[model samples]
Target: MSRAGLAAERTALAWRRTAVASMITGALFLNHAVINGWRPALIAPIGAAVAMAALAGLSYLRNRSLREGRHSRGGWVVATASATVVAVAVLAFVIEFTDPLP
Candidate 1:
């Protein structure tokens, strides 16, 4: 495998890790929501799912780039995915501060 391919694989693995974390967090949030209400669980899953999906998309795009020798798309996709993660984090914070729970 070339350097780009190796890098893409490593990034994909990292994305998987993020997905696992998000999944766990989402589960916890679901439990919290069940104990409380729909507000908490809904927000957490939305944020977590977005982040996981972004990471998945990024990894997929990067891997495709590596396979097709289109290295540039990898960078753009990674950046976009990272940005999405940040946005999700911000949403989580917003939910925490202004919880919709009653």
Candidate 2:
């Protein structure tokens, strides 16, 4: 692969790493929700996990397009994914630290 392709691969790998970390956060949130005996609290983390999976899939597709000499607005995708991950994390924290029933 060319150096440019390698760079793209590296960036994609970084995104994947971030996604994996977010998955861990999701797991923790889900676990905490279960411990707290609140079934609804699982929603936020579950959604985050689903989003992470989608993001990962997009990253793979973006990489494939890159290898195929197709233009991909990966920067936008990465930025959006990162923001989503951050939002999910914030939501999880809010749900975790606040009382939902009272």
Candidate 3:
């Protein structure tokens, strides 16, 4: 594969890594929520999945642009994905740190 192809593959792998982590988070959260309550524990994983979907979309766009020989706007995608990841992490923290209902 060419360098651009390699780069696209790397980007895809990175996104896949994030998706796997998100899936793991969702599984853990769902399990805990089933044992605890459905409010905070369940919702955080939903947000993570949403972020993962967005990241996957971004990666797809990057790959498509590269394959089409277009100027892949990968930097913007990376930036947006990174920001979304951070936001989801903060949301997860808020859900985790909050006290359970009485």
Candidate 4:
């Protein structure tokens, strides 16, 4: 394969890695919610986990696009990913404030 093809392959692999990471993050968030017991405040972590799942879905779509050579700018994917991260951060802050340690 040419250098350009190799580059695209690398990009696709990167996206796959990102999707895996997002799934792992979502699992961790879910685990936290479960461990903390089923309080209403635990909803924040549950929501965060759902957001992470969405992020993973987006990553998968981007990866598929890259693999298929449909190389438009990924501005939407980047923006959405950024928004998801920010939202997750905010949710984490809320969870921390609402769930006081013993």
Candidate 5:
């Protein structure tokens, strides 16, 4: 394969790793929510998990595009992923600092 092909392969692999990481993070968030019980206060963790799942889905889409050689205008995808991460981080912060409902 050519250099460009190898680079694309590497990028695809990176995306796959990112997807896996996102899934793991989502699982952790879900686990935290479960461990904390079925209180309304656990919604933040649940939302974080959903965001992580969306991130993983986005990563999968990007990876598929790379594999199919349709590498056009990925800026939106990256932007969305960034926003998701920021949102998840905020949710996590809220979850960590807030007192559990009585």
Candidate 6:
């Protein structure tokens, strides 16, 4: 396998890690939202988690294609999703800080 071949595995692993982190961050924001009755704030992390799942699914498909000797799409989408996750994490933190549990 060429070095590019490893992109599939590495990107997949990164997406998995992002998905896990997104899930945890979403849960944290969800808890805060529930506590403070800020239902709209729940959307940020939910969107991030959904994005993470989509990225993971895409990575899985890309990896399969690569294993079959097809040219894989580059990592731009994964990088974008990672950025989205970071943005959501920041939003979650804002929500958490602004509305502590009483």
Q: Write the residue-wise lDDT of candidate 5 on 1-102 in tens digits.
A: 989888888888888888999999999999998877878877778888898998999899899989998767678988998898888888877777784653
Highest lDDT scorer: 4
Clashing pairs in 3: none
Task: Write the residue-wise lDDT of candidate 3 on 16-84 in tens digits.
Answer: 666566556555655655666666446666666666566666656665565566654567777886897
Query: Which one is best on TM-score?
Result: 5
Writing each residue's lDDT as its tens digit, candidate 1 over 3-102 gives: 7678766765665665566566556545655666655347665556556655655555555544565545455665776786687677767768866556
Q: Higher lDDT: candidate 2 or 6?
A: 2
Question: Which regions of candidate 4 deviate over 4 angstroms?
Answer: none
lDDT to native, each model: 0.61, 0.66, 0.65, 0.89, 0.86, 0.61
lDDT of 5: 0.86
Candidate 3: which stretches are off by over 4 Å? 39-45, 56-71
Worst 10 residues of 1 by lDDT: 65-74
Over 4 Å off in model 1, which ranges?
A: 1-9, 39-54, 57-72, 100-102
lDDT of the structure predicted as candidate 4: 0.89
Q: Candidate 6 on 28-86: residue-level lDDT in tens?
A: 65555556565665666556556655655665665555556676555686577667767
Q: Per-residue CA lDDT of candidate 4, range 1-102, in tens?
A: 889889888988998988998899899999998887888987789989999999999999999999999878898888999899888988887777878784
Which stretches of model 5 miss by more than 4 angstroms?
A: 99-102
Identify the runs in model 6 with alpha carbons over 4 angstroms from their true place: 1-3, 37-71
Q: What are the models' TM-scores?
A: 0.53, 0.64, 0.60, 0.88, 0.89, 0.54
In model 2, state the lDDT of residue 27: 65
Model 6: number of clashes? 0
Alpha-carbon deviation at 57 in model 6, angstroms: 5.3
Residue 2 lDDT, candidate 2, scale 0-100 = 80
